[model samples]
Target: MQPYAQNWTHVTEFVMVGFAGVHEARLLFFTVFLTMYLFTLVENLAIILVVALNHRLHRPMYFFLTHLSCLEIWYTSVTVPKMLAGFIGVDGGKNISYTGCLSQLFIFTFLGATECFLLAAMAYDRYVAICMPLRYGALVSWGTCIRLAAACWLVGLLTPVLPIYLMSQLTFCGPNVIDHFFCDVSPLLALSCSDVTLKETTDFLVSLMVLLVSSTVISVSYGNIVWTLLHIRSAAERRKAFSTCAAHLTVVSLFYGTLFFMYVRTKVASSINFNKVVSVFYSIVTPMLNPLIYSLRNKEVKGALGRAFSLRSWKGQ
Candidate 1:
């Protein structure tokens, strides 16, 4: 072993310092997160089921919505259960093996990247629908939608491989304490004893590319959508057109807002506590809110949900 390597022992595991010094409210925190997790699962599953069973929703828009719901389910799952374990003090709720940490980081990064691209695709779908109604059917046909969705997944799957492999190769010698709830990229990067300039630069460049491209698409799509909506002569027709895009806009704002603050910033490790708070919004809160945002704002989704449950109710009776 090298002299520096010999000086310090390799870290086998890491302790996640999640909400440390909060022993007094562990139960309360556990209850809140548990409820949110379960609710997120139920809501996203309902969306998938409602969209699948209802033939009326067999369109490109609903197809993308179902993909989003499924992504949210897996996205939230990658981090929240481990967080809940910390709150409940399971094995002190903080210890994770090195392999486990990297696995979490890889999965989380992949899903997040996927959501960014998927949201952009959804925005483009809306733009085509509102801005070019005449050609929307041909432009966003099922084949096109399938291809777009597959590309999003493929890019997401590939984006994290380099960053995560770099992270796994990093030397975590002693002080294996992660200051965040889960093994996120920043926190893990902060804990590494190895020189992480290359890793940080690689991660930053990858993130910037994903965020810039995705956000640009979303912005341009919405810009045209807004322009088209403004040109409609009737106020009612304008409102109707705008409503279709509202839920998606809300979700995109919530998701991308936190992401921009967290990743595309000058100082990632400046404030650990604040980072945790912001992370909560995107990783935990946004998934829970997606179902509510879409279902509440969307008449079609609401109607489908009602019909789904009511049909079951009638069958039971």
Candidate 2:
């Protein structure tokens, strides 16, 4: 490693070469991304409607589900829309100005950090539901849920701006080319001409907290949930309990899988591409999938959605 001041002098605004050299496949890329974004929006909106109108779905599990859907939609929007625009090859490989880069970083970090907290809240909800059903309503009351939701949003919102400010202080005097697709912390850090000692440490520690700590909470919480479920005597109740958790499990796995893959980099560019692909999953595809996964497999959501839509149709008539 070189001296912090000396080596730092050689960095600037990153030029992101958009996904794959398949700039020629821009049309196909646009079609796929556009379809996915639409799915994300519609499916997440349907989830919100289902959770809102259905008495059964008004519980903590679905309440968090509604917010998670909302987060996913917004989270994906922070990056996917721009990436989709990049698909035209006109703006593809376009040099992102400093402000645009920071905005991307801020939104992405806010949503990503929010996700870490939200997933923890969701797991905690499951724990209460499965371990102490009678007490769950008391434990995860609407007030508690709102507090949790607000905390997720508030902390998520605050966490990124300081870093963005830190990043902003650095001067970009070198090659303006960013190696990856988006304005992620790591890639951005790699391009910074400043004292990144603190920045690098912050990214590593924060990423560790978000990814590892949250994963552990989900692990421990679910472990207890499984243990409690084993004690259920009624097979019907057991099946229902298992099914309720299935959607959350899917979402957690998908999000964690993609996130860890994206940041867990080595000294290889091959892994970078892998990270980008998984990044798309958490950033674009997973949120859209959440509503669909929950809705398709969940009887309550499906029922609620039907009722809400039917009511709407009746009003239209």
Best by lDDT: 1
For candidate 2, the per-residue lDDT at 312 reads 75
lDDT of 2 by residue, 148-235 (tens): 9999889888777766777787767666777677887766666656668776666656676678777898999999988888998999
Prediction 2 global C-alpha lDDT = 0.78
Instruction: Report the Cα lDDT for residue 27, model 1.
Output: 91
C-alpha lDDT of residue 6 in model 2 = 55
Per-residue lDDT tens digits for candidate 1, residues 244-266, read: 99999999999999998888753
User: Clashing pairs in model 1?
Assistant: none
lDDT of each: 0.91, 0.78
The true-versus-predicted C-alpha distance at residue 232 of model 2, in Å, is 1.9
What TM-score does candidate 2 get on C-alpha atoms? Answer: 0.88
Check candidate 2 and list the clashing pairs.
12-172, 14-178, 15-176, 15-177, 15-178
